[model samples]
Target chain A: MSASPHAAGSTETRQVYLFATCVIDLFAPQAGVDVVEVLERLGVTVHFPAAQTCCGQPAYTTGFPEEARKVAAAQLDLFPEPWPVIVPSGSCGGMLKQHWPRLFADDPARRVQAESIAARTVEFTDYLVNTLGFRLDAPAASGAPLRVALHTSCSARREMGTLGCGRALLERLPGVERVEHGHEAECCGFGGTFSVKHPEISAAMAADKLDALTASGCESFVSADCGCLLNLNLSLEKRGAALRGQHIASLVRARMDGAAS
Target chain B: MSAASLPQADARVSPEDFKQRSHESLHDAHLRQSFRGAMDFLVERRALQFPDLQAFNTLRKLGENVRQHALAQLPDLLERLEARLTELGVAVHWAETPADANRIFLDIARRHAATLMVKGKSMVSEEIGLNHEMAAHGVECIETDMGEYILQLDGDRPSHIIMPAIHKTKEDVAAIFHEHIDGAPLSDDVNELIAIGRRALREKFASAKIGVSGVNFMVAETGTLALVENEGNGRLCTSVPDVHVAITGLEKVVDRLEHVLPLYALLPKSATGQAVTTYLNLITGPRRAGEKDGPREMHLILLDNGRTQAYREARFRATLQCIRCGACMNHCPVYTRVGGLSYGTTYPGPIGAIISPHLMGLQSTRDLPTASSLCGACGDVCPVGIPIPDMLMKLREAGRHSVAESITPPAQALVGQGSVRRAGEVLAWRAWRVLYSHAALYRLFAWLAPRLRWLTPAWQGGWTASRAALKPAPRSLREQLARRRAGRTVPGR
Candidate 1:
């Protein structure tokens, strides 16, 4: 495997560790597979530690700091080595990079481990665009006729600055056109535990996302985060709307495979 | 009238009522759609500007310290600020209420023989009903902030704290401008819309006898007033008019310029995601000698209006530390979902929910506290680390206590235990004991008896008629657990 998408005839491949988020692990394993495949194809050694578990975001968001610490400690123990731990989901990645250090501040041992992990943690799109400088390889199609709207997850857009990367990757996809939605940066209301705690707010925010998506007249919606996609999809289902939501990786993977055969 | 004879008001909505209203508002299709879109825009824009939370937090801490230090010595600083302003030939007035503040400004305008007042964006002005009060006295106050200008033309209150007309779409703004601006061609372009406002307000700025503005921070050391804005209209408003008047909350003051930097860093980022507002106009003692532009006469009105009360309460003092950057509203799940109009107050969202009740009184704005879901997102995002959720709970308690005090003794007795023995009476009452022990049977009776008028008392039936009781499951969880412990299958299973 080459170290990067641009790396050709390489003598050495960079080692990349995958932190398959809980949602991806249980619900959408294909997203994890897509991540691994994309990384491996881009000339990187992919490692998936079987011991990896939840990022403790669920516990932390729910105000259970003690339970969150336990989960964070376990994650720290699992990823002891210093390698870039690229995560597909920005929410989980944010928990590791931003929240874990704060969660373990009282414990010196855990804090040190969390800090080390945070230093190496990066969201997948950000890693590809910033670190690897993986420019979009495909050209915009002249006239295949597709209009795609992008819904940026709160974690990806707010916690992580992956908006440019998400947009860039989408704009490069063949036969796809981009339409900017008003209030595109707003939360889809899928704030992890917030969805269950305040389902009303979550549902309201999701409905707002769907409205913007529908207003854009986009055939399909693309987002970088799966949690957003799932919540948005649920909102769409509730309203009996027929709009498709896809992860950026899924779209990229499909694009790479030449229009889904 | 005596306090007891002030005309008893109905009890504000209960927490249960607020929850139901919030739930309905959240699921409302149009509301949800609009909120999601608005939140996404703010979140994306903010992230692009401030990518590092650690850096943001550091700046936020510094800002908090500055506010806290200033608040600690507020009396001394206010005196010092007055002395400096007086030395510069500017008048300073202290107003204890909205009426006092409004009267003070109107009196200043009257003394200046003012006709048209060129006003910049000031939430305090809104708080005191300055425009309405001035208008009632036949004074025209034209808003200079572009967002405020649009809302003023459309005759609407500000919807968002920083972005006042955030609820208005480009088309809505275009229509409002076209209708109000004497046949100016309507355009959806924001810059074009601003240009239209600029042209319309240019005459007002030049000919206006008096100008009114809001200070983001008031520095005590040099008696300098700071106004941060993107439009530069604040500068125009302060400089162009012959007389300039600033009305601001007393909480806006700081000890010195040294304390203003961290706040400068945090305010813009939290408000509009800008590294810095386009204009940070620092006016020290009005215009110095030989100045070409700036007010010949300057006045700063520091309005307290319940801030002293808030500052006295240890639990609520942190509220005074709010710089009003409005990040709390911007990131609030409830605020975005329900929109600002639902808040029914000048300040909206998580911050408003906590502060409005205290400022407006518990009875007037009691619904504010119950609007939150206790999601804790607002507390996390607060730059000053204001425990918004905790404060909200306290406000709810205050509301309940106020309600209990005001109601008839019989009504109050229904909610409260009159004496120490009454508590035991409540717990040991056979009906109440049975209701507690058998949750399922209690819920079933509650649901079924609402339909049977003969079985329940008029008061209890009236309460049930007004609000639906909780639907009980066939089997209680405790009963199911007990059956499971006995190694028997439950009926439902």
Candidate 2:
């Protein structure tokens, strides 16, 4: 697996900024911890900038550009070391890489700073598969067989173009089988404020997604974004169903630990 | 045809009722299934046609460029189109508003004393409330397209742009036909239902004094109106009557006949997954001297209806590039679940969300832009490469802010600017900006939230409605990181 095309030869010890997205920071801190564990085990030093608050996706996507710009500007100085900024969630990483430059389009100084930061920003799964060559096979892959559906967030699919990174990482795990679900490319209806603004429609979409994943007969699911995991896990919990989703970071970390044990 | 057959009162489907309508639609299992099935089918068919991703992207780029070029020289091209059409003996009318469009239709109907006017499927006509206006003035406008004819008979608005009656199952259509049309029997067979509709529309076409249709593209160089349809009704409506009135949004004009080919190629494939539609009527003039069959007189109505307002800003000008393929809706997860009628507008789904704000004003369509999950499906599948999600975000900003507050104010404010901007929501965002932009404040808040997790509320506004309440984790990631960096193992891990 380490010799695969997705594997990187540059796994020499390197320091990188860890941007535990606000969603994972507050509600799913274990996922954040797992992200750190996964990175560190792969011969990388994870630096968590305490001042990092958010990637400003909620404000930006909710149509508050001024607020979003100000919030995004706050984090521009955090990753000044020229090291790669690893964001576990593709949604937040996309905000940094794709939208931050647009948000600061009129301000040349901030735009340059934003572009520099964006150039170094990479989603956790992409960094693992593409940069770190962290594929699991043989000894690492020997574990209790787990079946899971992979839900790629819209940002991962469309913005950052890391749609295949999660699947690639999982596919290399010999004991794991990725179950395909209906409308696999569709959204999970956790579009930040969109869920609250249009609850009925959002819930309806979430319900359909849940049905599709359940029908796939996967024991659980994994996604690279916390927003989607929160939406799906909570909905599953509400329905008193055992089918739930975990962040890809947490899933990978657990799989590694299980193999070691 | 009886005037009573037309829908009464032109109350533009108000987005104010969007929440309620969507609630009803979400609860309607049949409607949900119908939309899901139909959208899935359309999406699969379109995917089958575009096997090579690179080829599809290249064609999409070309389609986008053609539309953008046409719009860049829109004023010049429109004038040239009018000049060429006038030389061909086709009357050209420019309408800046829906009222202006209706007035032109009424005047033309009166000139021809057109009591019976047969229409091809025209979303523009729906936008201008043409059917109601014509009926009010004692003119019967019969929808000749099968899907539209079904909707018209049920006094129901179109739910989908390409497939108007998509929300209705075959049984529903059978019931509609059985009750509405005299001597019509109930039948769920697709061919039988289409035959029944064609039979009814044929008689209407024969007696109609005027024919009305929508243009897919208008070529300025050759003075041609391009119409694409699966049904032959668009051709019939343009040629069978003594007079033809073709209406289209002003944005449809292209510089030449060649420019129309790329857009034409993408339209039907993106629309119904067809390599080519059954009828492609290119009307250069009313009729030539030796023409066997065509309308004697032709009138082309160029409708603005808020399109000029959209064109004023480069950010939203992409809205005009839409070829009305309805591919956006077909690929949208939100549209698939909620169905089109939930939008409460002439157009529905992703395209409708962006364009309705311009067409009907932000006040009436403020909620429309927020209807999507920003899934990016619409933008991906768009034949002409309309950046629909970005346009929606722009519309959202326009709806929530005043002209002075806009990051880059347009030359003129959009219609109903700041219509949805409430003081409470404004204050909430302001507070959010405060908490997020200040690292110290955000850090303090993040620390306190998990510590005070016990005090979290059980019922979050809409969050707890269908999902379990989201509670703060025992410790935030920052706290864990701090402890780890301090050379102390985190308590939990």
Candidate 3:
């Protein structure tokens, strides 16, 4: 609709079908809103199809495959192919793109459709850097650079293999400084039903994640998965720790708004 | 020593014990720190072994192929192995269960009137509760491996398969030795501790009536047993005594000698990151008629235990491909934090999580499958390319009858297989399926959940315990989308 700021911005029409994950849809609506706004500000049309509900990760990871198939099959017709289906969370994005075909492996015809959807689905930050090619070269800032750490969820790190894309996003934010924690490869322990089944071990792992992030000397945190956000943010509150984790979409949108001025 | 006189474990593993152990382990600051340091060292050592990911994956493919092919022809290879070993003057015994294996060992020791028995690092022996059984029969058994010896002195089970005493620090080992050793003082210096261990075991090796060790790989084509070790004590346990008994599960056999080379390269590099361990002893047979050293008689015990059960099923057959490297546990976040004893199983961590279910049945090991975070770190690091996370999911499914029946149906109901079932938990999952299946119900629940956010339950297990209240937003995203499309000025906007 509008010309993008990129020097080599393509003249072809672009659109992003938003798959606002279940965790963000119910728990943190602001993440979904921020994701849509950041994409809109980049001169791309963002569509939030009302028929979409969830990507069915909660039951799938918790050893309920039949239930997962029922829920994941509902998403096949919600968005047509050719347009990239951008997802806010890497965990959900991986479920749609990487694991959907696994759920439909028993059937050949549905598996083809699942693979087609998987090829077009992209996580928000990955689409931001790799597809859109949006770059920030010392963009305008509203205040001093905010020191923050990034907590990459295990699903995002190992399953989706998108940590490099997450890093590229952090590097593009001119006013946002990224700090690396020691145990970056470890899980935050909010493993779907695992957090509910084994509480003590989950709390211990969350405490370790917080300690590593706190020790890295960051004011706050940003993560790609809302499951980690809900767990870590709550754990931080329980301990009365000043640290809080925001969705990466919120961080990127806020920095983009300041750059627009 | 008859089968009627066989003794079971004094304190059998129970599912309730695991819950208690995990609670205690999570609270123990000392145990947590020790496991953290030890696991970090192990993981770092293993990472240095595979700087090239492609090369590592290629080697894993070869290892997996060898194991799958070996298991495909297990019965034929085993028969070949017995004939070859018999020709080499080695006694080959077949055991169908832990009780049978123990009885065979005790009968052999009694025939020799063995008083003192020396042992190397053998997880199979621990799996069958052999040390305690031998001690009950009035045979003095001493653990010869340093880690096993320390655990024996401390009256503890081996926490890790490869590094049994890894949970103990230098100071902890020193204190354990100072309490148990009947000798001069040894400081915290590791070399001094090794010397003390070496000196204490040497006399036992010289005077022991029999020695026992674990086999890493038993070549079926030539009937040679390959023992991989870094301590050099395995060589002593197999060669120093008048009689040597090398015990291992039937899954340890490979088709040919060359099939063992890929696994040998994988085990040490995965266990302790050595290009080749200090000792790679291949025992083909007993000492010849005029040999100056080595055992006078050698016995190889092929214990089935529960491997035959696993080998019969295609779903769990991949579990038999393990090489006892312990890399899976080293990379597991849960095992490292909770330590090994919390599992209350002979083998702990990822491999234990998958294998113990088949060996001991699902009733006792129900908690092991749920212990992981499903991080896939262990699966990624497995040298033989065992899909550990996928296997963990299978165990979780088999642990519950309601879920397993729903997936596989009642016509093909799993028989003789043990599973742990909870009625209330089944009702919960049933409710979950009902809620997620229908979009209208999901939307209605989403609409009400946020408005009733204050009524969020505080008793959501670990969720609300250490985190803030999980209150949903006042409005759903679909609600916002509808208002925006209708040309309404959203309050936030």
DockQ of every predicted complex = 0.06, 0.68, 0.59
After superposition, the stretches of candidate 3 with alpha carbons farther than 4 Å from their true spots are A1-9, A141-143, A259-261, B1-10, B13-15, B402-406, B409-418, B488-493
Off by over 4 Å in 1: A1-261, B1-32, B402-493
Q: Output the TM-score of candidate 1.
A: 0.59
Q: How close is candidate 2 to the true structure, as a TM-score?
A: 0.97
**Would you estimate the TM-scores of all the predictions?**
0.59, 0.97, 0.94
For DockQ, candidate 2 versus 3, the one ahead is 2
Q: Give the Cα error of residue A169 in candidate 1, in Å.
A: 29
| Runs in model 2 lying further than 4 Å from the true structure | A1-11, A139-141, A259-261, B5-12, B488-493
Tens-digit lDDT track of model 3 for B353-392: 8888777777778888888889889989999989998888
Residue B398 CA displacement from its true place in model 3, Å: 1.0
Docking class of 2: medium
- Largest DockQ belongs to which candidate? 2
Ranking by TM-score: 2, 3, 1
- List the candidate numbers ranked by lDDT, top first: 2, 3, 1
Better of 1 and 2 by lDDT: 2
Docking class of 3: medium
The clash number for model 2 is 0
Give per-residue lDDT, candidate 2, residue B264. Answer: 86
Q: Arrange candidates by DockQ, descending.
A: 2, 3, 1
